[model samples]
Target: MNKHIADTKNNDVIRPTQAEAEAAVKTLLLWLGEDTSREGLIETPKRVAKAYKELFSGYQQSPEEELGTVFEEVAGYKDMVLIKDISFFSHCEHHMVPIIGKAHVGYLPNGSVVGLSKIARVVDMFAHRLQTQESMTAQIAHSIQNILKPLGVAVLIEAEHMCMAMRGIRKQGSTTLTTTFTDAFETDIANQVRFMTMLRSGS
Candidate 1:
């Protein structure tokens, strides 16, 4: 990318505030052939704008900060910190439809560990975005690995993409599973096997 273009992209990458969000919603309403000024629709744009802010608030958050608060209390436990079945909802950018699913996350801490809830928050952050499950999986795993610098990191996402089910071919049974792994989870069989088995059993 060109220097100026890269800078522009970085600056524009931040979350849009109410006014911008409202404008986008208004545009959508117009495209749908509705008068946003009508009684019921009058505040609909504003509501949508506010909802988008909350839904995509991940852009305003710092994954590093969320994971930075660590605990030294786990002591000698060498096992992976597994948090399974975290329910999440997001929009697919391709069709801007809801993608709902559960995320199974695990990490092997090396002397330090973060709050268990923060892992879920990290998952929510990226999931709130309009994303492909593949990027969502890798982003969560990479974020955890980068912040915790754990012995290993694994993330799996299983989701129903509404873009496919509600439109296009409209296949009801379609679901996507995406995963990402690092360190021993990536190169070591026993570690990967254990993690996968644990995830399968929903432990």
Candidate 2:
């Protein structure tokens, strides 16, 4: 593994260039005891580089930019904004395999609201990257909170990480749940309960 991956931390995520990615692929191909120069596999490095570019495309985008455009008129609505069972697929930073799951997001509007589809878009935007579920939850909540500036924001992700199930402990049935809450959602029980009840009601 490249040592550079260990010391780099840019917060949003690191996106390596095409040559860098191809070099990593070549390194792996050689370590696998395969002739990377064979005609059949000659272009594997380039294809894998392209695939990674697509897989981790989330790093290239800003969640704030995605959520920047919002609506001020919400029909004078005042209630918990809940979007549940929003499906997501992400690559684990460790193993780079898929973490397939659903996310439940809730927020209390502070006189402004975002498009419903934008919520799912935000989830997808963050998920299509190399991440820990912990960071994924935090990024989603923080991004929404930063962009919409909602009164409160809460996010929960229930997922199955292939890194754990298909490797490590090999426990297939176990699921990881990660939650992140901000402001009223963090300090107020009533607000937290409201979000939890909505999550339960949907389930």
Candidate 3:
């Protein structure tokens, strides 16, 4: 485990314990007119608490640790390395509903490259948190740029917010796209175009 992970665990001391979390769930169920003592609902609070533990597991992870290992031997190959169509599931901070999406990440390595799976793990770390798509996109790009120290970083996310689909105007089949670019990807139009082109090519 990384220092950051350990620090996070230490900080978790202030958060609710499993019993408290379950109690809160039961309170919510009772507020919604559900019988907490009913056979079917008796264990619902515990189940919900367990589910929330998984849903927010990202909080237990550290992006710095995930991207800590970097390989400097790239055989002098320097261009753009991109991974596209990386799927993710997140929840809206306000509504706590699902935000299903795919992330396309690219970076220009500066004599160092990280493992491909690290990029995906970075995406997962941020997605598991409750935040808006735009915020998540920027967080992913910044984490790469900061940890990998690449010449540039790019992140694009396309997601459908269930909050919109399940309520509040009830728009289905609607997708939200958010993108973040840093360094060369932000200043160089050609770099941006190349990243976008590769993302569209799906190859």
Each model's TM-score?
Answer: 0.89, 0.86, 0.94
1-203 per-residue lDDT for model 1 (tens digits): 11222223247554455576677888989999998888999899888877876887776677887787988888688788899999999888888899999999989999988888999999988887788888889999998998888999988899999888999998987889888989989999898888889988865
Candidate 3 residue 7 Cα shift, in angstroms, is 8.1
Least accurate stretch of 10 residues (summed lDDT) in model 2?
1-10
Tens digit of lDDT per residue, candidate 2, span 145-174? 888888899999999999888888888867
Which one is best on TM-score?
3
Cα RMSD, model 2: 4.1
Per-residue lDDT value at 46 in model 3? 93
What candidate 2 gets wrong by more than 4 Å, as runs, is: 1-17, 38-40
Model 1 per-residue lDDT at 33: 96
RMSD of 1: 4.3
Top candidate, metric lDDT: 3
lDDT for position 139 in model 1: 92
Write down the worst ten-residue block by lDDT for model 1: 1-10
Give stretches of model 1 more than 4 Å off: 1-17
What is the lDDT ranking, best to worst?
3, 2, 1
